[model samples]
Target: MFQYYCGLRSGVKPNPSSKRSSFAHKISRFLKCCIYFFMSCIVFHGIIVLYGAPLIESVLETFLFAVLLSTFTTLNCLCMLGPNIQAWIRVFSKNGAMSIWDNSLQITTMCSIVGAWLGAFPIPLDWDRPWQVWPISCSLGATFGYVAGLIIAPLWIYWNRKQLTYKSR
Candidate 1:
């Protein structure tokens, strides 16, 4: 019985090498995600407030507006670019490219909102000003960032590989 138990335990245990890499990779990814999220939030909030836009007059309205807008916008964008982005991500990761599309998209979207607020006339119920500018600019910026990432990723990967090869030699 003891021998059987030991055998079972060994079989159930994870491979130590893969476990270490998995943990390290998770930690690195998490740190990167945190930095990205923090920066995006700061930029988003700063732009909204800086533009003198009224802070959602009511708490419920603000919450609802944020939820609705985010959901709709995310869904729309995902519908348009979700597959392409996923494919690009897979290709870039496989090629060991330093693809910054994910990061840049977030940043540019935030920047667009800021730009909209700055450029738009902030009048409640006035669709002519802020609403019009924000989405258009955001979409344009998102596209620009994506295109930039594609161009930059290959160059970055090549440069890094060159550096590595040089150091190894």
Candidate 2:
């Protein structure tokens, strides 16, 4: 019984599945993701600055951390089980191919951006309280928007799946 449990029965060895990538490969891919993350952060921060959002003493630091949140939201939406950065990149490309997942994520990302922008409106109201800081409202909005998107995505995909028609590329 002990030998059987230990798999010592007949010169048998447990082999890992071929579907998994090697650790080295995953690390390399993750490093590439890091570079993309940094670049995207700079771009997002620059746009925010250009739009005159706020002038925090630590604006760069704030953006550096906020980009992490944004990336996490976007990437997880695109590929929850196995993250495909390339797939997310394809969404921004011209004449890009679209799948149900791709369509859902793209819409979700846009909704999140809009939601975040909308969240800022409440800050200027008569409620002069403590939590009305710049970008905080926007961040909260983005978070809520992403959650809403997550909730809506499955239903959207399921409802539209049958209606989706193929087009000649």
Give the best candidate by lDDT. Answer: 2
TM-score of each: 0.32, 0.68
After aligning candidate 1 to the native by TM-score, how far in Å is the CA of 18 from where it should be? 3.9
How far in Å is the alpha carbon of 74 misplaced in model 1? 12
Location of the lowest summed lDDT over 10 successive residues in candidate 1 = 68-77
Candidate 2: tens digits of C-alpha lDDT, residues 78-155: 244234657656754554536766666666776677777788788788887766776677777877887787778778
How far off is residue 17 in model 2, in Å? 17
lDDT for residue 36 in candidate 2, whole number 0-100: 59
**Best TM-score goes to which candidate?**
2
- Runs in model 2 lying further than 4 Å from the true structure: 1-23, 56-61, 72-74, 77-86, 93-97, 165-169
Alpha-carbon shift of residue 6 in model 1 (angstroms)? 27
- Predicted structure 2, TM vs. truth: 0.68
Question: Which residue ranges in model 1 land beyond 4 Å of their true spot?
Answer: 1-15, 56-119, 122-169
